[model samples]
Target: MKRLLLERALYPLLGLAVIVVAWQLYTQLYAVSRIVLPSPSDIALASVRHFALLLAQTWPTLGATVLGFVIALVLGIPLAVCVANSRVLNLTLYPILVATQSVPKVAIAPIVLVWFGFGMESKLAIAFLVAFFPIVVDTATGLRSTPPGLLELARSLRASPWQVFSKVQMPAALPFVFSGAKVAITLAVIGAVIGEFVGSVDGLGNLLLAANSQLESPLAWAALIWLSALGIVLFAAVALVERLVVPWGHSGR
Candidate 1:
């Protein structure tokens, strides 16, 4: 168990520590301006100084990210199922999905803000837009990729469509679904931050922007670190869920 923990956690921690130490040394040796590059210690100090403010701002971003990701999963999986199971739906909707994904989210964020106003709704919309594509694509792929032998065996047993789907296809697709989910969750954070950058009254993105405008480099860096931490946490949460729901997927790892 101890070795497992070290293998899973310690290597990454050590790598991050090395990077931080190198960053600090470089900044100190070069006497880099804080505005250009604040050292790790400076960022840490700023984080401590603004802990309350950071915590307060984090809630909005977290809420938007989680809500948007949930919405994506709720809608995307059903759409994917339809597309995967029906030739007609796949022909009609798959093209549309691809086209919509091709458009840049940044370009549409402002229009979304106009529609939903400068509020949580707009952020949610942006997050949903960015996170939706991967979920649909991956899920549909997974469903379609289920082993033909298993599907044929179910059909030979005279299983109903729903039963086959529930028992065979979904289990096969669990890994793919989780893969898309992990990607979508991270993209959701980026989406929320983009929305905040486009128009927002609060959030870590807003705080980072305000700090930059005020030339508070340390604070801006601190906000950036917090955003990274938030993304990591969300990603880990999704991974934990994957481990629970799809335990066999990680057996080799």
Candidate 2:
């Protein structure tokens, strides 16, 4: 188990290290100009020089992403419960949920800005819209997947409905819920960036826009790197929580 865990951790780092070295070698071999693609060293230097400003920009995007994800989480699980428990909602709303995802979030971003204005409100709405469906679908599947044997045992014990749900169904659903949350968190960041792209004056997306407009490739790469780091950090956080809450779920992984 320890060897498995160590390999899991080491493999990604090894892959990343190889990628970075190859990236550096390719740029050097081709004599690639910074205008087209900044070298990793250039990005590192730019990141160091502009760390404070980039961090300041990061705060707003991170805030928007978190708020949007929280809203998605608060509403999604209960809606899933309704859909899972009620035949009517499952038949009606499932189609609606699937349909919502069909409409492109980017195309609606301007209208969302119109509705919620240029503040973080629009960003929140965009993030929530982008992240909501995955959570609902995953959680509903988990809730419905409660084992028949477990349900029968709970009934035999004379457990109340609440007890059965809380003890058996919720636990069974948690790993799935976390899986959706992982996807949602990354979506939330992308949603925030999209909102910023459409209207906002600040955030990493805006920084990227400004940098690219100025032909500051290194700075743009820096912003892109920061955004990627943010997504990775959030995803890692969700994974950590999963390990703590659903230890047995790893057998499948």
Best by TM-score: 1
In candidate 2, what are the lDDT values of residues 1-253, reduced to their tens digit? Answer: 9999999999999999999899888888999999798889989999999999999999989999999999999999999999998999999999999998999999989999999988888888999999998999999999999999999999999999999989999999998998999999999999999999999888999899999999999999999999999999988988898899899888776
lDDT of 1: 0.95
Which segments of model 1 are wrong by more than 4 Å?
1-4, 251-253
lDDT of each: 0.95, 0.93
Report the poorest 10 consecutive residues by lDDT, candidate 2: 244-253
- TM-score for candidate 2, please give it: 0.94
Q: Write the per-residue lDDT of candidate 1 for residues 119-227, one digit (tens) a residue.
A: 8888889999889999999999999999999989999999998899999999999999999999999999999999999999999999999999999999999999999
